[model samples]
Target: MAKNNSRNMSDQSSMNGYIKSICDIMRRDNTKGAMEYIPELTWMMFLRILDEKEEDEHLQSEAVGEIFEPSLKYPYRWRDWGSPEGKKRKELQEGHMDDFLNFVNDDLIPHLKSFEEKTNATKRQKIISQIFRNLTHTRLGSEKNLLDVLDKVDHLTSENIDDTHQFPLSQIYEGLLLKMGEKNNDGGQFFTPREVIRAMIRAVKPDVKHNGEYATFYDPGCGTGGFLAENYTYLTTPEISDLKLNASDYNHLKHDGFWGLDNSFTAFPIALANLVLHGIDQPHIGLKNTLSGRETYMDLFEGAPYKFDYIFTNPPFGGKEGDDSKANFAFKTGNTQILFIQHIIDHLAEDGTCAMVIDEGVLFRTNENAFLQTKRKLLDECNLWCILSLPQNVFVNAGAGVKTNLLFFTKGETTEKVWYYDMSDFKVLKKNPLTINKFDDFLMRLHSDKEEDKISEKSWYVDIDTIKKKDYDIKAVNPNIKEKEIPKPDELIKIIEESQVKINESLQKLKELT
Candidate 1:
């Protein structure tokens, strides 16, 4: 066990070093920020990882007596272009900078994009085309910097995956995501905090015991595939649980039980890279705008009216869908959040479960027909069981100050009563964000039939009738807590100063006694 721990630490250290090297190269290259650096960095990393996976796949196939079709020919593979001996690297070292750059932009990208036309192409191959279709050479305009980045990425290999000296590539990729998500632009849309993802996964419990072999998970607006990656991790990792299952169930889930969709051209590749690091060799994340129409991505939903057993996502909010996109939904709304909720209702299977992070406006906004109708359908068709009112700072890092709630529900049952857990009092901020440990009190109350203790002061339930009387308003109001008394800024400052003085006096007296 000690030896294993040592090896893991070594692996972690090595991986972190590689990531630091890449970031250093990015900085030296004058890449703008994570928004510019990550995508360009990811494009190179994707090819390198894909090449390694292909090698592993080929070896496994040979052992199993199966044929492994190669995606890229001799010079096109990462081993050919990315390694030290590779032509691109050699050319860059020899001062043939234009030659190397032109080959990548002119030959390499076009070749990758041509995979869509390959006859009998594997699904992975098709995805390669989909991923590289819009990919442009964003960074790495400098040949020497590009070579430096490639050299760093080339050090990442499966053999070093768990070595104590190396950081796992997945950790590095997620780190880039964290950086990219700090952008206040559209790039920030791809990040939902991993803690939030884990909380939702724990609440929904998407696993084989509940869903069985047909167990499947889908994310309609899967930003950078965080939920899907975490969901896969949750199902595969063994723990004491209520679910009855075996190794095969876990295996099935690891390989074939997840799908994600996002329309953003930029986000799709990052999502693919994220899932790839999670050991999903061929993730079924579609790149279509989910709101474009119900008929969109028919290939993904064959039986179609409702296909997913578990749906989890944080849909893009505060934006209106175009009229062309709105025409597809029954609840004709320009509101992106409403349309996504409607889409979830449409694609969700009978007995399917969903845990989504929705804008706070979704709870009580009934002014528009689209908002009211969507909420009405949600209550009428699903067992809208829980609304976890998150703190405002939950998304502060992602540049969103708009409040959000985690809505957990099952599809087959009608809403009777809704459980509301108000976490607003947690006082979380970007630096001291809410962690999964903080969710234990709420989860315990949810799992047990026992009502919230008056002392706990942050949970309560409301009947469906009461909700209907109030138009399904789901804001969490902890009846046990007394209304807060507002204090002026000056008064609050005086109170803080008084408290500090008392604390200092107590400390001074204790010191004198000692």
Candidate 2:
């Protein structure tokens, strides 16, 4: 991981250029966009890194007089087939592109995918098998281009990179993940911005090891593992963490601290590879539909606790669930976020805290039974502490234009009052993306104990009594903002008639001139 760390901008630029070059090569053969080439690149990169890591671990075990069993064996590992001078590559021979592609598509992939079928598969073996399960064949249209790709990935080693100023592979993979989310047009389910994720993590920095034991941090709908990844970075970075975490703490945080579930096959493997590159050796992510109770893969999430100590997530907005998903919950609603709210309330520990990105509609629209009951349950069960109304176009870069809000609350207490911060009046543009600096004032007031200090032109608290009086429509309406006066309907119609008469007079004058 240190080999991928960057010391300056030039190193990052070099890696960016390198990755772009690889994409360009893949584009020559297939250009259906990143949906086609990114997955191909992901498996290659994963195997390459995995092989190297196991090699190092093997050496370390040998030094300690321990026998090591590798996750991969001879003629199947990257060095045996992916490299140009590899044994399998030599057997296929140069100029026999058909033979090479056939071996990979027919033999190597199937062998790798078989690891999960074994009754006694090791944890690493299971992870490897799952990562390669989706790779049925090579996406590269040209066998020659495929060889070029393998050679490029083969040369990607720590010694080949400028170690003093190399770009982190984790950050590089993140850039790739952004490409998958950019302008994704499937119902405007935009990926959560990392800046927003970082702010949320800092706002509720849960102890990685809760109650002197391993604490679980979960995301119900983790997209590419952004929230979990940022939380790891926050806890590990020295300047950010006040506690002096030792080696054992770091080990616990890496293996047992971060857990997530994503329903996307496209994103599931990418999330695994991304977390591994970020130094999370054991990412407990499940490839299952969290709401529908359907699973493609949950082998990695075999021992998840019934509840979690902390939950940080952005549930899919503007989506609906079927009866299958709604049936398991206390509140039966098609609203995706609403059902997720119910699920969170059930799964959160008694002392758990959650920071979720939600649709603004949930705060208002007192029109349905499910909506009203869900909000009532949240208020009665949890201390609904704060709601920050985000700007309308905050998701413009990710191709969504809906209004969003951040909800922060803790379980085991009824809400007495709720503090609200209004960032809705500010304009959010693609050129000026929302940054963490925008939350300085919000964070400052959030930490203050005095009620008077939290009141401002853009911040105020609403008592529970007032919230109930309004039927629980807790939308942030700025009191300091003045209402604009409007003319009556008849006056507006008269003004339009006067404008039409002026237009007719102007047209008559033009006719006279002609």
Candidate 3:
């Protein structure tokens, strides 16, 4: 056990060093330029790790070890830089030495000789060689002195590499999120708050036990794959230790059960890489605009017969462009949030449940084409379960406070009473000033299944029909009022005098202007 612990610590240290080296390269170049390079680096590192696993039989016996084996070999895998085949392989390897040294320089020529192919395209081969030369010279080589660094990294458990090692990556992603949030990005609408994601996953509690037996899991507007990753983390955490499944079994359940879609080209790859890092190998994440035309929708549903058991997502908020002719459904309101709500309703299985993070505007606004009707449809057609009111500053970093709520509901039978948890004070502080971690408390209460109707300071339940009559508005409004009399006239006069002098000066300025 001591040896194992020491080994694990060493692995963590080496992994940390690799991450730092990559970040240094990005910073030295340019942050924006680094984004392009980082993804390529991630891909190469992934491939190298995969190749390393294939070489080590003991590691291959582990649960996650089986999934990292690379099967896809484009033509570039065969070419040599000095020769035609070497050049092709080098082009695809980017600048990562692991591929150039292991595959192209040493392996490809001998392997491809059986095919009786000669090296082709000398000019293209030279360009590929130069690129590989630059890549081989990077800090990656300095960090990995003799496969010891790679061996050390292989020892890192998923738990050790959580959000910490991924922080720099996350910072880079946050920049992408910010760019998405900016005007003209058109992709910003799908960026959901991480807190909102945690809250939704907490409410549903998707676990490994519920895997094969339960229905599917999905996210329509899966942005950077936060919803999917959170769900995957929720199931695999030590909290679910009692599930007693091996790592391989868990990986299979996750890869097979989780599915996601996003239209953004950049977001698609990021989401796919995020899942791979989180242990869901070969994730069913695809690039498809969920709101595309009916034909496109039909194409998406072509061969899949399974319905989702649970759906958790924060679809792009606000309305989409009205001029786009390829929209899936004709929504009366131009609001895209309503469209996502309808899409959730359409795709949700009869036995499935959904926890969607929607803008507060969808709760109370009562225009003909507004989300009010969609809220009514949920209550009238499905089982409206709960609405969680999240606090402000939850999404402050993203720059939009459109107060959001978690609309939890299930398909099929409608429940007469819906639960409303007023968590307005469940504030997530920027600096955690009060040293309060509200989510810990919130999860405790939720998992306990305490009676929410009985009044509590921060949380309570309300009747579904009552909320319906109020147009399904879920905001917690306290009716208690306190009245106080004004101070003495002399004090009031003194306060008025202070304001009067400033008013007189403003009036004189206006008179002079006239």
Candidate 4:
């Protein structure tokens, strides 16, 4: 155990050092800060790993006496252009300084971006195309810096980082995502805290292939694919739970289980790379404006089922849709969260489950038709089992100050009552971020079968009739928390008179001293 611990420490330290070295190179070469460097690094890391994965696949296929079709041919592959010792790399190194930069800017990027336009593109091809869809040119300003970044990424291959030093490659980007999520980074749309994602997945415990059909997990707004990646990790990691699996189940999970959609052109590629780094190969992430009916590249989502079995997402809050987006939903309004609620309802299969983070205002603001009608539709169509009133300012790290709540519900059953769990009193600050351990009490009572057993000062049930009377105000209002009463006018006058008499006594004492 001691030896293993030492190896783990060494692996973590080495990986961090390597990543920081790459970041330093990026910082000096026009890319500054997390927001700028992460995107440039994302493509490099993804290609490095992609080449390794495909090479392994190629060897395995060859050994099994089967033909394999590689994604990129010849000079386009990372080995030809990016590898430190390869032929093209040698030519670039010995040739004019401008040669390498020109090749990348002129040849490499355009070739990669042209994958989507193929006559009959493969899934990988479509993915590659979408990943590079927005990159019209290279971000690295010089050949030396680009080559350095390439060499650093190449060093992180599976061959270099053996079993003893095998840190998850996904973690390298996760930290960068946090920095990008900071205030003014404009990358919060792709981040929800990992702790929050884990807590939600733990609560949901979404199953896979329960009755022969493969289960599907979806996210409408898959920011850096945190929920999907975490879901995969939770299901696959043995220490978390004992989920017995067959070969078919595992294969299905890798190929068909995960699906997502993102409108942000920036988030779309990052989400793809994030899921790929998490070991999900066929991540069906469609790059489309999910609310506005705008299509970017949805070829990967061609055969997706109309309704999914499970959804875990953190949709962007404070979003307002235009007429084009609002026209599709029955509740016609600009509020994005409400439109998302309606979209989620329409896209859930019978008995499907969804646990999502939503802005708190959507719950209490009943004056808007979209807000009230959306809440009513949710209760009428689904069993809203839990509404966890998360701590206020929970999303401050993401540059958001709005109060949030976790809405967990299953479709095909009308909500008779909702179990509200209040964690609002727990103050969260930037230094002391929220963690999974903070949810111990809530998780302990979450599984209680009896309604009476579930009732506590922090949690209780509110029936449908009360919710209806309040115009579908489904916010978590704790009945146990008593509001402070206001003093009447006469009582206020009496208190003021008593205080004035005391003041007079003090003045008399002062006058005597004078």
**Residue 208 shift from truth in candidate 2, angstroms:** 1.3
Ranking by lDDT: 4, 2, 1, 3
Q: Give the residue spans of candidate 4 off by over 4 A.
A: 1-14, 159-167, 397-400, 450-453, 485-514
For each candidate in the order shown, give its overall lDDT on alpha carbons.
Answer: 0.75, 0.82, 0.55, 0.83
Q: Where does candidate 3 stray beyond 4 Å?
A: 1-20, 31-38, 56-195, 209-212, 240-242, 246-252, 294-303, 323-327, 397-400, 426-429, 433-436, 449-454, 478-495, 498-514
* Tens digits of per-residue lDDT for model 4, 1-514: 0011122223656767778888999888878788778878888788878887898899999999999999988887888888877688788778986898898889988988888889777888778877787787778888778888887776766545544412378777676777766766667667888888888988887777634578899998887889998888887765664677688877888889999988888888888888888888889998888898898788887788889999998888888789999889998998888888899999998989999999888889999887888899999999999999999877754444689999999999999999999999988876777889998788878976766769899999899999999999888999999999999999999999999999999999999999
- Report residue 160 deviation for candidate 3 (angstroms): 10
Each model's backbone clash number: 18, 2, 12, 0
**TM-scores of all predicted structures:** 0.84, 0.90, 0.67, 0.90
lDDT of 1 by residue, 1-514 (tens): 0011123224445556667768888888787677777778777778887888788889999999999988877778887777876765566567654877777888888888787777777667666776676675546778777767776677666554663312256676877787765646457777888888888888876666454445888999887889888887676555623565576775666556778877777887778777777766667776678888433232322333247889999998687789888988898988888898998998898899999988888788867887878888998999999999888767754444788889998998999988888887788766776788888887777777655351256777788889888876677777887888999999999999999999999999999999
- Which one wins by TM-score: 1 or 3? 1
- Prediction 2 TM-score vs. true: 0.90
Give the range of the ten consecutive residues with the poorest summed lDDT in model 3: 76-85
Model 3 agreement with the true structure over 182-279: per-residue lDDT tens digits: 44344455556555677677777765544356446788778777787767666666553334557665755554667877766566655665555555
lDDT of 2 by residue, 428-471 (tens): 67677788898888888888898787999999889999999998
Model 4 TM-score relative to the real fold:
0.90
Give candidate 1's whole-model lDDT.
0.75
